[model samples]
Target: MTTATTASDDVRLSAREAAERHLRALVGRDDAVLREDQWAAIEALAVDRRRALVVQRTGWGKSAVYFVATKLLREGGAGPTVIVSPLLALMRNQIAAAERAGIRAVTINSTNIDQWQPIHDQIHAGEVDVLLVSPERLNNPGFRDEVLPRLAATCGLLVVDEAHCISDWGHDFRPDYRRLRTLLAELPTGIPVLATTATANQRVTDDVAEQLGVHADGTSDAAVLVQRGTLDRESLRLGVVQLKTPEQRLAWLADHLAEQPGSGIVYCLTVAATQEVAGYLRDRGLEVAAYSGQTEADERHALEQALVEGRVKALVATSALGMGFDATLGFVINLGAPSSPVAYYQQVGRAGRGTDDATVVLLPQAEDRDIWAYFASLGFPREEQVRETLAALAESDRPLSTATLETRVELGRNRLESMLKVLDVDGAVQRVQGGWVSTGRPWTYDAERYARVAEAREREQQAMLGYLRTTECRMRYLREQLDDVGPDGRAADCGRCDNCGGVTLSSAVSDASVAEAGQRLSRPGVVLEPRRMWPTALGNLGLDLKGKIAAGAGPGRTVARLTDLGHGQALRQLFREDTPDGPVPPGLAQAVMDVMKDWSSQWSSRPDAIVVVESATRPTLVNDLAEGLSRVMQVPVVGTWAIRDPSVPPRAGASNSAQRVAAVRRRGGLDADVPPGATVLLVDDQVATGWTLTVAAVAIREAGAGAVLPLALATQG
Candidate 1:
């Protein structure tokens, strides 16, 4: 025992000296020093070989601690460190930092599949010091079964970056992150593990710490030593601007973006808003571009660089820019409020990192609540759906692809994919190249647990509402929401925010700006691309549908998208279930007529007649629209297609294109007696899959119609 203690003390002294050297190199300064807590974490990992959790705020040098410890461990003849990073952007940043310290780091992710072999070779040669991978890669069947076991046996250190994602209690819970437990259980004895995050609250911190499991002393109660610090940003001056309408918000943003701090981000709640805002800003002569999930990866990288170099004034973005993004951004302007205070804080943290003073402003709008509810609806699957999926996979003789299973399931493709990921983590199923197969493991549907999470989400949203209504210091309210009441002796008010500092931000917008913004928002019409081909996979379900649709719905137009910030609100209310179906509203009728007149050139000829696609839920709305168009054009209302079987359950709202087409076929075909080679206009209340219009147009074309023109008030999901 005495000999072991002496040896450990010697290792500790050497580790500290090595840590300081690496820290200096890492920071690119000879006199640089590590924080007391940073050094403590390094000691725990490099000397004691203990598990640790560091929950410090951003810009707190969490990555430095890991890199320094890794250098020490590798020098002591330990294998390379393995880090599970949450984002590609984060990995990019980490790799550059590691190289600065003269530590060799390599990453394996989807983007560099071809280079993975060379990276693996380097690790086998002991030429690599660190290996970073995203959580999703851990579930790769080949890697999990073969390569991961070898890494587990020889890896010197295991690091989980943005580790809060591991816990469902976390603001962002990724199913793939939860799979880390399997990796944890398989690690060789005496290997130190580290988990780091800047945004986890007390609940998330404790949860992640427990998962890290007992320290090097063989202590079992808490496996990791968790070190937390205050979530205060002294440089951030937080404020809020209340806008009565979307136009007002856009106007304010246009009027003030140039006057705000340096290059920054303008966050929108949706992709549509980003496009709209970015367009308006560009029209205002501000250099800006839309950045969202739809932006190409290469362009996104360029945009990130642009912001870093202050080449672009701002990049209007969505939550896609919420995490993983690293910038010394000078300001952050939120066009809409996030659903939770934690999410808000996480986003704002991206700014004020490099400067002494940066602006963080929130422009809250009532529409934000509707957007929140739309996202909230996509929560966990029901027990029936889970059991159905499991039973389908278990009963199959061979692996069934997602496309094949779609025929037997009711959920949409995206939702099904998300559920499969969760189930894959739970060991209920396995995803192979051909498709997925059941693991034959028994699984329980945790209804109560999911319900608790739902309730928690509701509570968080309410807290956000509370934040918007609070009169105290804006920064303090946010900190308290994260349960970050700082040190016991810390000041209650941050004194940097609008409230505590007694500074008032104006909501004034110049008349010229308001008119410009109003015209931009009210500008109508969205190109509706016709369905060129039937959605693939219909034949897999035994339907004779594949390849280019020989007969297709042509290019069309929608007055607006349901997600549009302009006139979509009125269109949505008109289609709501509570709003009884009736004749077209006079204003909507006028708008439709105006749009048609503007699109007259697109049509080959005027309509000889108007044909309405039947709607069980809104029969009156469709019929009224058809009749109104006919009356305005002085054409006859030819006929309406009726659903063949009232007993058949509702199918108009089917999720996928293929299924939606099948449902329309089952409902009934078009019922029209048409003269050969006569032009007819087809009208529907809304276009979703566009399958309805395609099917109707096919029937009409087969009946010898010269052209079928499709029109609708809105395009929806």
Candidate 2:
């Protein structure tokens, strides 16, 4: 994290200047256009010979730095510069840029494999200048056996782009990057190696260098370039919105689009959710496109073209669309909280590239709260997990199924898979024929040293995660991590995050009040009595009803009458008639009525039916009421229902009579035939943050349901 130290006194022109003058003359350049800082970094790279890790933030022009180093060594009569990039599109872009700069560059990828032989011949003949290859392409035996040997014979400059992939701590870790160290070992010493990434922090930089075998004492003289004092476009305003329902979220997005009609991307957590959101947007009269891993290449290309041509104003996507696809997007909206800070930054960076002003909006859900909590609980996977994952992968001779690993390791399937992917990127294992296999080498300085380093790296990752979950200035955190503290010793307030804007709920109130309110409304015995008075006992008490009321079922069904105020003529009438054993006490009815009224006003903006139960009420009152309402209203419930306390755990021969009836009601029961193109209604007992309903709605749409509506007894605002 240390900044580059400067010389105390400048020497006018020394022996080094004379040698540089000669070298520049041979390279056909009169002067090095690189800034002093860049030149110092380049000189360090040239002197150090080992791999150089450069952690430069956005707009620092990392590509230019590496290009200059490549030219210096290649033009100085060294070997052809070999650059391993991550994406084929990026390879093409870099090669095109190089060619435009009048530098000879060639790329070997899927499309132009036919030209690979000629490129190989040129490199071996020492006629090629810079050779760009995808990591996947580098793993090809044809290139490894033939072209690599020639390149090794005349080793010059080796450059790795998206170098963070070499570290387990990186967001976009790739397995191909792990084999890079072994590949480099095949070449001779004295060949200067450079690794460049825009997002790597100190931990990532150190791990990447170690993985590449660039550090001898596990210490690297890596330089971190912080793009401090730059304004992130005045046009771009970051905002966060808290929503309680899927319908509200959709309506909000529609309003947002109406206000700003431009190209944008909506990032979702899952492919299925992306598709659902895209459909919902389209239905709402917006030109929308969707992309995910499951999407066909041609379809994705067409979507991309549509967005670029202004034919589609919005795109819903998973993270399948990666770092290098440069689009002139107007906004980037995250539908749920990102799992990591690096992911959040990368996705948000997609917007505001060309627009005068753009926006990055985060719509967090309750499910995402679990995601953060899970991350907090595990923090980062411990060193033991890493070692176990590696040892298991090494033991497997073939590409091991993630499910198998999960069973054996006793780790959650998703977590285990993520860790395995990280290990694969660090070069400890490879996805073999059918399972993971050992790469026959450890990532760092044996087991003990690696364990220590792994523990330290985990702590850093946990700290970063905590920072991301904070409601503070994100830009300030970035600056602090890069060691560029402000003059006032305090980062500038962003005035955007949930914390700064005072949008977050107080811990005490959010934890106790919302849950208690939701519980009162959704409780099994809760009943709503009709009210016909304004400013009555319930109204005077300032109660709001927020949960569902269960009514009895039979030929003459009991009603759960909703009221603005629970204490009124309706409650008095019900007590006087229904409770005949004694003269119904006014005080008790008024108190219960007050709670009901408060719950209703707090939940539903409008009043409706009062929940009146017959003499009999079942254990699953909520489910029964939901089923009865769906039948009565003839609306299909789009998701599954849970009976909180089943009489008995479902046995092999037990009949699902309740389930059958519910399914019948869901498909439009005997009461009414299924309406043509009727929208589906998803019913739930209670909602904390509406994430379950959102997911259920998406599933309904995917199942060919015409429209989806969520019906719940209670919800958290």
Candidate 3:
């Protein structure tokens, strides 16, 4: 057997032919052949051993190029390929495809802990051909410092899937993906590397291409970027509906989900939307399931399988199921428009892959930017916050867990973790065995760069808005947004979209279905699960509260989550920062009545008395709540939980459990005596951590109340 080592395309005709044969077997078809560009990538990676980035459209055979290349290289006695994929769904689909081609593939991810050792043993024995890992896996101290270095040096081909995430200026900015730079530097020279993504604007393409360069002391080696595919999915018919309200959107799905060709996806902008829309669909007799990052791993797998097998009408999901779910979906409808055109293009790409004539609809909403703003508000915190974090970690001799850091800083837990990851990439901090440790590296804070990224995001928002209102072809608009040019410099209208076809999509859903949807969403109340266990490491904050909260801190009811579909919008308006801290108006009081009435059956017993928590900012609201309950439930307003320090207001409901517990403990007390064995209803404007209600219940229990039920206007986490 003879092998050609040069990457010259003309020198590897035999190998490329064999690669096409393997591709046919992989796709399970008798007449499958590689497109010209697919063979080009394989030629570069397998024969030339040159670094490359392939910016092809979804379903453009990018994976086929890598798989065929891996097979050919391994046949020539090369080492295994290492692919860093972003999502578990993508990994599962890729593994199945690898098996069809008789390639031994295995994965290392957070979900499959039990199989990691066995998989590692197989790799050590040289029995595996390809390995898939998530970007977060690169941050695992054990794997990064130990296993990754070995894999980098020996792997025949390195693949970065969804490489758009590697760019900070991109819409989907994942801080962990930046960790790829370390692995890029670790790979030996001439070890072929492939970076592939479906959604990258010209700026992102240039940035990722530059980053993928095999730099040696601030220089680069030759690299090829194959970006030939036009971003048009010819099988799609795109349309947008500007709905007046969330209920109308849900009504549209309820009325027409079954009208979609087959099992598909109904994407929601938030978990709240997913839950609300999925529940409404189920009520209307659609076999729909909700999937989100918050869903348990086992349940998420079950939902994905259900959708794949066509057992459900649709999966109501967030971006959790977005990256690479391989079902050949027949349709995809968004509850609201995604903030970025590039992100929207990537998501809609999930449909129309293996089928003809798939429907893609965007229900652009008035509240879309409101939801986007909610996320942006939590983006990269101020420079002072970063400095405080570094100072906290640097001053400590031992590694500090995130819980410990929360005591020293006011940042939310999620935001704090995000900052840590970004700082880790910047070399100022590192995740170690116990937690995080400062590396003492002098890091310069680039405020200008962050501002530029933020401005880029705003531009993306505007572009997405343009997509909704554009009179041109929807496919052409998205393709141009991604900077994808065809064999001609610009692509033409496909004559398939609603605009090009001159057809107005029907928003004329049945009136009866719309009424039912409105009823479902308007009916309020989300069960407020009580805090069972106390937050860990409260002792670090000088509060020794630990273990489970007391029994009196039982399950309760809230009118709505501040992010819910029903009264949430109204309550949010009332809770707006500029809203006057006044008494609850009669209308909102009635809304509370509706929630309590619906929740009447869930409570074991009615309250014997009402207790209000003293709110320094909303005293009138608290007083009104107590008084209104006294008139409605015929229970006396017994007392208020007094604040020890009136100047220290309660933290937002989104605060970490540790800080909320500490704050509550610091200012906690029951001012009035309670009747022994009396049931109490604790009233407040909202519950975020549930600690406020839990601590109040404890004080009431100490005063001899037998039962406590927390009732609040809103709840959040």
Candidate 4:
């Protein structure tokens, strides 16, 4: 790509020359040559008024784009540059860089609330050139009521960093992002707005535009410069291992650590998991640290320092480690499957920062299959959920606590929170003093009008899920999802995915070849319930199962009984209701009650089990039930289902059975064929949904599985 050249190429030095001059003047180095692509991006910024989104991989000098823009704005006598950044660390880094370049930049955040008054005065006094503030800081009343208004009067330019936060589809959502639209509204018109992110899909692009009040029609005078660069790191080798046991996974990690020594990340799903794994790794003689949301700010800072200073070889962390830190981490091991591809991409993107070859190993626990299945089944939040959440926020008076907001909206808390935060970053809602409040009016378009747009967003999410479930061309899948067209006119087939190994496995089915190759696997049991049978079951059982589960419940103590389990008899007698046919199984209703109580106990004890469902049915139903249960129970449902093949000799409804099993496997991650000695269970909405049960039984038998039990809501058969 040729470097971008200004219209006045003769008078205006090329972007490269400008960059070199600035670098030489600032760092006393003239050898710094701007990359052709970086120069193109910088040059485009000079004249382009359309909001531009610069997407460059890490270490690609993304900051230089802004640096060049800053210089241009300053030279042109544009108003003082105001940067909205997500992280205090990033703000500090930028401020330091600017200071080193002899530019007067000031950062406002929590730590320097006292210094902010002077800084604010200086900004209005025209002493400060660049002002860096966190999204949260912008939401402050003082800033909003006093400082921001003053700054707006003398506006230079506004830049939003990590701008993907504006997309509800982005992995990391910040509530402050929603206020940007209001902030922009207050700014003088014609001031350039530049949004930068290393990762953003079309969904992100639309969200950014929407947040900035840019229309989808592309008629806005504001320039929309999108530079989609190659995120491919040929030096990075991606490997995924499916492990049945935690021990085996840890062993593999240890072996990998020993083989390749350098800075690395062992990413876990939870804070406790990070601590446990970090401790274990440390015990195994590996120098390690832990990072998670629960880690104290001081402690996290120390840990980061340790990593940067080479005092630690590895850090076991939750997703919290990926965003702000700028270390050249060598490897990243996913101890569990990330909730989404965006997460996986962000986590893995942290590695190979220095351009040298690195590795990203995904050690997906067998249990992770269910997590992936749950994600696949639900796909992404329905457009209704996103719309509803945004609508609720738009209607609210002040920022409401998540609990308070949940009572008003019909969505799972976590899912809702994630969505709200995304909208928040997108400038739909602002985080107020104690809670989240609407930044502006609700979307005014009729639901029917945006239905297609919503569907497109859903398709994009599904595409990402498909990439996760894919066994072929992981890189190709990623490139396709990003809509990246490489030079070859074909999707770049990253040589690292399982498919490129000459191994072809259907994502719809587990990679049996790999599974059978002695890679330990964890195959969840199938439950005898409609994949989405939670609502009906909850209603029929006359129990708020979600409530109990959230209170705390243990898996071992929770038992669901059918009509054959005897409790059904008592339930029918107590309620004087007719039994649904067949033999009223002994202890069924009582077993279900016990399961409900136990589930509650488990939830209280371990939040991870807070969202447990008694049955897993069809994909759509499963998604509905899970969403309902998550909202009602205030916990995310770990969906369970049974799997069976429809193509057996004695098969009745063979095709339906095969389709159900396929669907369940595609969504819930359980298979009929479990390894020998594996403890398995059959879960279903009703025993009449026996196709999945039969398949599960046959496959378990074939695999020499041990102790397969049936867990069902009803048995009409």
Candidate with top lDDT is 3
**Candidate 2 stretches greater than 4 Å from native:** 1-51, 109-118, 125-128, 137-155, 184-187, 209-236, 305-311, 354-356, 370-474, 477-484, 487-490, 494-717
Model 3, residue 490: what's the lDDT?
Answer: 72
Estimate, for each residue in 1-717, the C-alpha lDDT of model 2 and write its tens digit. 122323222331232353355335333567845555555556644433445666665444456655555655665677777888886546655675666445678888766768988887887787777888877755554665566677765867778888878765676666557657656565565666777766665567667766655333333334422222332333445666667644445455655664553788888766645765676667667788788877875677677767766788878888776565555777778877676566666677767666666666777654554434434444335667667667776676566666445434535454665556546546666554455667878575256654654565455456555654666665555445533346675556665444555223221223333443333222221232221121111211233311221211111101222210112223323333244333223443234334434443434222122121111122253445444554554544333523233442222111121222222223321112223344544444333323334333333444444444444333222
Candidate 1 worst ten-residue window by lDDT: 1-10
Model 4, residue 589: distance off in Å is 22
Per-residue lDDT of model 3, residues 302-405, tens digit only: 89999999899899999999886788799999988898999999889989988987999999877688788878788788899899899999999999999888
Q: Model 4, range 555-609, lDDT digits (tens) per residue?
A: 2321222221123223323222243333223344334444544444423232321
Q: Which candidate has the highest TM-score of all?
A: 3
lDDT of 2 at 282: 76
- Point out where model 3 deviates above 4 Å: 1-10, 214-216, 226-228, 485-491, 585-587, 652-654, 666-669
The deviation in Å at residue 577 for candidate 1 is 3.0
Residue 179 C-alpha lDDT in model 4: 62
Q: List lDDT for all candidates, in order.
A: 0.83, 0.52, 0.84, 0.57
After aligning candidate 1 to the native by TM-score, how far in Å is the CA of 54 from where it should be?
Answer: 1.7
Model 1 reaches what TM-score against the true structure?
0.94
Candidate 1 per-residue lDDT over residues 605-711, each given as its tens digit: 87897778888888888888888888888988777655787666556437566667777878877778777887878888898777778888888888888887888
